[model samples]
Target: MRLFLCEKPSQARDIAKALGVRGKGEGCLTGAGVTVTWCIGHLLETAPPDAYDPRYKQWRLEHLPIVPEQWRMQVKPKTASQFKAVKRLLGQASEVVIATDADREGEMIARELLDHCRYRGPIQRLWLSALDDASIQKALAALRPGASTFSLYHCALGRSRADWLIGMNLSRLFTLLGQRSGYQGVLPVGRVQTPTLRLVVDRDRSIEAFQPVAWWGIDVKLEAARQVFIAQWQAPKAACDEEGRCLQQPIAEAAKAKMASAPSAQVTDVRTERMKETAPLPFDLGTLQQLCSRKFGLGAQETLDIAQALYETYKAITYPRSDCGYLPMSQHAEAPAVLAGLKRADPALVPLFDHINPGRRSRAWNDAKVSAHHGIIPTTVAPNLDKLPPRHRQVYTLIRARYLAQFLLEHSYDRTRATFECAGETLLATGKQVIEPGWKRALPEALAAQPGREPAQPLPPLARRDQCPVRDVQLKNNWTQPPKPFTEGDLISAMKNVARLVEDPKLKQKLKETTGIGTEATRAGIIQGLLDRGYLTKAGKALAATPAGCSLVDAVPRAITDPGTTAIWEQALDMVQSGEMPLEEFLARQSAWMSKLVERCKGLNVTIEGQAKAPAWKKKRKPAGARRAPAGKGRKRTAPAE
Candidate 1:
């Protein structure tokens, strides 16, 4: 008999239907000598330290670093019955098939059960990108040998064990030390959570310590041929800051005085250049989460949940947890079918039918760039939008728009910069005129605003050496504003772009190209865990570190809270996946490093600072139209864009 092990019941059911399996068994579906069983996530979990030796549960400092000689995994109490069913099938089956999500975690999910149940048989792997019948049939036609992906399992196992060692040892070590200092609350540390918490703590400290500096500027209104435009006065280098904000009030006053007296401004130079902007590639999970947070104020985990439903429940999209945004070249052939299905599902999309070209291929399709799975996109058969929930429909639209953008033309425009001179002071005017709104038309109304600089008002036609009559001149006082608190979207972007914070060039580039401290599938969970543990709090849309969270950063070694170090470990895990390093060697190095870090901090005095209160996000939002008046009115100038 052939046994198929799947990651979840929904996944198993989908596959069973595709394969014509109709008979149902206890915790499984069976037909025609083929049996399919599902796991509710992982059926077994790593045994805790106490499971190794009951004495370790008491939490004595003497048992500080609980290192197990022979690691053990026991069946979880909640899923033990399913485990038993799988065990029975594994014992009787002539061959086994791993039909799980196509990722490292899924590999571990199936591999761990095989190891635990002591199943030794010929194994084949099924890599499915979507639960839709068409996709399922495609995947079934190309079954890969189990060994082709076996390394992913070891890589995932290494990460799991490393996290266990770090979390189990360090959390106990700090909690005991905190107890010694009279703080009763348990201090939880993690491989990724600690660094994420530190990001908020560091940002809060910077905002608190920032000092605002007053600056000066002058805006002049000039008119030529009845067209008026604003020109900014630029101060001389000696009296200006690095960003050219006039630092000395006297200097700005002097320039404004001369410009006000002048009757006309001379245009020294006029330059215009054509520019084109390509549409962004479809989103990976990280980018999708960020956009959802920014546009809809959805939490990271909430976005992930909706995307997962779209992939599994509705069969409306491909995998939602993919790390790659580039599409596989093989998928481009299905574009016409996907487009037709989309139009059929939603009447609102009918007008765009003529504009979309299925033959046009964008830069997003590249076989070499795809890894395991391609971008999350609409499946060939689009589900009925009327039946889908509102949130699901909105998210689906966002994903669909990105894919549709690939078939549209590039957005093109003409950028113009005009330099002016007035009474020994330099003045500049910039503007842009849109020639075409290409891919932007594909965006839904809610996402049509786009993310970038505010479009400049188009300047009236001008030539070199033209004199424009000055209408008005005003000198302005502005203060430099501190960095704004991070929204969930901002935080997600920071976590993914953490490479900018690292000083090393090689590691910096590698991490920036790959991923940051966490995988696309786990970053949301890490953030949600931090919130549940009270290490972080949410105010409106902003994230702030709690008192306990701040104290934890100080108590632990800096390396533990460093995003760079954590990202390095993520890269090492990649090495394990590529078979560049043996799993045992990777774990050995991790164990040695963890043991040393634990030893160094064993004797430190620890005092955890505050009690954890309920997270602020759960509270009702205040009514709109409430605004606190500022002390005085002054235009604020922001820092230049990086």
Candidate 2:
């Protein structure tokens, strides 16, 4: 019989339904000579240090670095039954189909089981993005050869081993060193999580050490014909700061007074130009998380959860873990079906439909830019809006809007800039008059405005070299503000754009090409892990690193906390994916690097001055009313107290 292995029960049912499998069996669904089994996630996990040698069970300085000579995989006890079911099917099947999440992690999930079970049968791969029936049926007909994606498994395996080496060896070496310095906490570390923690720590330090600068600004109200608009006093270069804020208070005060006394000013130049803005590309996971945090005040993990539900539970959107914001050109043919479904499911979208042109393609549809998965967009079928929970509806609305925006015209506006000579000091006024709402009409009002600034006001018509009255002059004092504390959304953006923080030119270029730091699928979890471990504290919508977190950043090697180093690893993993590097070579280098780090760090003293203490292991207390008999007094045959 042919067997199909899937990532989750929901996924198995979807694929099985398309394959005409209706019979339910032990831990699987079966019919038409095809058997489908699933893994809850990964049924197997990497074995711990103690698994190799009993002596390694106790944490000691002597056992600083534990690099496995021969790595082992153990079945997760919670999912052992499913493992058995899969193993049993593997033995009986003539051919196998691997259907899981279509990513590096997903490939690892399926291949690891195959290796452990010694499955030597012919294999195929099912690459799926959306859980909708149409997408599943389409994927079923074009199954890829197992060899096409075999390298992805090796890449994931190399990452897993490298991460393990860093986590086990470095964490042990540092925690032992910290204990001698009178600190009581296990200093756990990982390649991604530690670097992520450093981002928060560095931001917190910058905010505390900030020094505000005082400056001055002037706003003059100008009147033309019957219309009144605001104009700013232009400061001279010698008396102004780099950002054009006037540093010399006397210069600003004099300009304000002179403008106040002048009744009329000559308009030296008037320029009007039309501006066009294209529709925003649909979301990848990072951008989605960032916007949700900024607009809805949702946490990174919370946004990810809602996006996941929309993809899997409601089938309202395509895959949410995608890293690219470009859609595949082939999928453009389905736009009409998707748009029609949106109109049927939501009445509110009806008015917007009149503006959508299904034939008009946006730049978002590009073949070369598409990654492993395309952008998160609406699927061909839209679920009832009323049936979705409030948060789900909010996120779905955003996703649907971006897809709808693709077929609309560019947002067009007329920008007018007028320069004037008032009381011998230069003054400038700028205004915007919208020519067309265009794609912006698709966005909800909450997403319509720029996040940090006020929208531009329209200006009255003006002519070059015309005289205009100076209505009033207001001099304002402004201070340079400190950097705002990171919101989860802001932090997510930081992780995705980490190249901006890197100073090395070569490293910066590498980060930009590789898309910096954690993968879209794992970034939310990285943030949540920091919170759960007490490494970060959240206040309102902002995130701050705790003392323990800050100490960890200060204690670790700089390269370990450097995001560029992580990008280098990502590049190596990509090389493996392209078959340019061997998996054994990657692991061998990682092992050697691990040994060197442990040797260097083991002898150094680590100081941890943090408020949150890592709890020391405590002996279990005796159960109430079940205490042992007084020392050696009743050793013979006394009944235990109950």
Candidate 3:
């Protein structure tokens, strides 16, 4: 019998349906000589410190940095039954096919289960990008030997081990320290979470320290035949260089002062040009989260959850957890069909997609740009709206709308700018008028105006050298605002590792080569973990680090807090995936770094007094209903430290 192991039960059901398997039994579906079983997320997890040593269970500073000589794995208590079912199925089968998601984490989920279950047999890998019926059939027909997925497994294993080394060791160290300081809580820390928290804290610090300074600019307005025109200030011909950088600010200020002193101003020149803006690239996980946060007021984790549900439950979209914002070239042929599918489900988008021409030029659709998975788009399975929950339907609509818009014509608009001079002072204004609302008409909703902001008014047309009367003139004083706090949206954008923020070019380039701080799949979770541990909190859309969070980062050695450390590890992991670097080398480097960090943390003098209180995990638990005891009737009971 052939046994099929899938990442989750939903995927297994899909596979079974595709292969026409109908017989259902405990933990599996059987038919056509195939037994399909599934794992419920993670069946085996990294063993806790107590699994290494009983003494390690006690939260003592003496057991600081509980680095296991060799990591062990055990079935997670909640999923032990599922693991046993899969093990029994694997034992009875003549061969096994690994039907898991084609990604690093998914690969780890399958391999670890098999390793823990002690399954040894000829194995094959079912690799498919989408869960749609056609994609599943193709993958099954072209299944490759399981050995083909070894490199992927190696990369996944390395990632898990790296996270474990950092998460386990640091969580223990911090929790123990918090307990010693008379606080009760789990001082949760991880390789990615710590750095992510540092980002929020640092941004807050920058905003707090910012000091505003005043600056002035010359404006010009000209009148021609009852029409007004705006022109550039000219700036005494020497202040600005060829590239437009003001070589001397003082000279420019003097020039502005002189212009103000003059009685009348004259128009120097007028230039008008038309520019075209192509539609935005397709939605990747990061870009989609950013857009949803900015547009729908959705948090990063909320967006991820919505997108995941759209992908898995509704089957309305392809993979939601992708980094690349480009589709494969081969998918171009299927665009029309996919759009048609969406149109049948969403009639509102039909008009927007009617004029779509598949030959449009968009770098966002380039196949070469795609990595492990293509950008998120509607799957071949047309969304069954009747079956979708309200939230899933909304998210599915978002995916379908984006897919249709991608094939539509580019949005065209006329961008106009004018400069005017009056009383020797220069004034400038600009306006944008849509000439053609092509793909933009299909947008999910109209762009929302910011709070306290009025919609921009259109400017009237004017000619060069025209003279017009000035209705009013006034100076507007504006303070230099501090850096804005990071919303979940902004944090995700920053985490994309753009490197533009880093002043050093070398470090920036290295960051690009490493592909940002963490993979798209892990970034949101890292942020969420920080929040769950009280290292970060939400104030409206912005993320603010708690006092404990700030102090924990401040107390940690600089090496642990540096984003470059994560970047370097990412580079090494990439090399391992590509077969250019050995897993042993990467693991050795990680171990060395871990040893150094443990030593450094051991010597640090970190105190929590006056800082944020430790989490509840560190707090003592009181007896149930002890608080309800009659006053003065019973001895006061003290809660023991957790």
Candidate 4:
């Protein structure tokens, strides 16, 4: 018998259905000598500090660094029964195939379960980009030996261990300090969460320190062919000319002299060009969250929850947490069928599908750009729209529309710019007129509803040297604005390896080579942790880090606070996976770093007031079954409390 282990129950069901398994039993489905079983989230979690030593159960400054000699895995209490059942099934099977999601975390989920269950058998890996039956079938037919995923396991293990080392140690350390300071809850901190909080805090500080500066600009209005044209005097030129001339002073002198001079303004130059706006790349988790937050006013967590529900419950969309924004080359053949289904389900989207060429060329569709899994998109199966909730219906529609839009003809527009001279000063104006709406027709509402505020309108078209009448002219006052606080949308964008935005070019190039601060699958959770710990708070869409969060960052060592640290580690991990670097070397470096951190924190002072005190001395208790009755009390037998 062969056993197929999937990451979740929904996935197991899909695999079983594809394999023609119709019978379901305890924790598994069986048919044709193949048994399919699933794990819920995590079957085994890293053992707690108490598991290493009973004394470590209570939070105490004296027990600051709880480093285990060797990390142990314990079955999660809620999933122990399922774990045991899967373990037994794996032992009986002749071969096992891992049918988890094709991503790093998914790889970890399967590998850890196998390691914890002590399963020894021929293992095969089923890797696919989508959940559709066709993709699954192809993956199954082309299964490779599990040894191919060994580096994935190493990367996963390294990630898990690094997170564990940082999270467990820092959470406990901070919790003890909080308790000592009379705070009631754990001061949660983690490798990813802390940096995310710092980002918010830093943004808030920038906003707070900003002082707006007032400046004035000259606006010239010109009338041409019964239409009014507007242009701004290039502020720097208006302030001073090539001969150190001040045009503003000259204008003021003209008013003082009462010399009504109708400045003859002419269009000095005109430039026109056709520009194409290609469809946006498909939705990765981060990009999807950003769009929903910026466009639909949805929170990051809310967007993720809705996307996950659509993917897992409705089965209308592909995997939601993927980072790749391109489809696999093989999926190109099914584009038409997927579009046909979308049109059938949402007839409103028909017009957008008319120009779709499955072979459309765009940087967004390159096969070489993908990693782990392809972008989130609609499956080939016709969606039962009625089965999904209203919000999920909206999310699914967005996903489908985006996928269809990708194959459609690119949006085309005519961009025009006009240069004008007034009062011996040059003014500039520009406009973009849509020549072909193309895919943009699908989401007109999304385009119309500009949430925050309306920006100034574009200038009207004009020919070179054409004379026009100025209806009105007014000087406008403007203020230089400070950097805005990080909206959840902005933070999501910043977190996607934006080291290029930093001033240092070397750092930017290094970060580009490594995957960003956190993987797409884990970034949202890391953000949520910051909120739960009171390290950050949401004011509207903007994130503001709390004083405690700022202090925590100040307290931590420089190496840990820097995002480049994670980037460097990611580069090494990638090398390990590519067979260019040894996993042992990475582990050794991590061990050495961990030791240094432990030694540094050992002598650090943390003060908490009016909280539960740690016990100074430990007492040994008898074995569970060998408890004795108190001597002074009645000889009556006492039972253990339930």
Q: TM-scores of the models, in the given order? A: 0.93, 0.95, 0.86, 0.87
Which residue pairs in model 4 clash with each other? 180-608, 180-609, 181-608, 181-609
lDDT for residue 324 in candidate 4, whole number 0-100: 78
For residues 159-271, could you state the per-residue lDDT of candidate 4 as single tens digits?
Answer: 66666666666666656555455555455455565666667767778889998765555666777777676776664544554543344655544432221244456789989
lDDT of each: 0.83, 0.84, 0.69, 0.69
Alpha carbon lDDT at 179, candidate 2: 78
Instruction: Order the numbered candidates by TM-score, best leading.
Output: 2, 1, 4, 3
Q: Can you write out model 3's per-residue Cα lDDT over 1-642, one digit (the tens) per residue?
A: 999888889999999999999899889999989989998877886676678887765656566555667778887787788888888897898998998787877777888777877778888989877888877887789999888777887787777677666666666666556656665555555556667777898998998899875433444443445545443454444555454444555755665555555554443344556556566666789988887777667888788888877777767788888887788887787776776677777666566656877666566678678888888888777876767877666666666667766766777766767666655555566655677777766666544234456553344665677545543332323345688899888999888864655555666777786456766776776776566556788987878888888877786666666776676777687788889989877777887787678767765556643344333432355421111111100010010100
Off by over 4 Å in 4: 61-64, 177-184, 237-264, 359-361, 384-387, 448-461, 501-507, 602-642
Query: Considering TM-score, which of the candidate structures 1 and 4 is the better prediction for this target?
Result: 1
lDDT order, best first, reads 2, 1, 4, 3
- The clash count of every prediction, one per candidate, is 0, 0, 24, 4
Whole-model lDDT, candidate 2? 0.84
lDDT for each residue of candidate 2 in 146-225, tens digit (9 for 90 to 100):
99999999988888778877877677677777879887656767777788889899899999999998899888888887
| Model 1 clashing residue pairs (backbone) | none
Error at 130, model 3, angstroms? 2.1
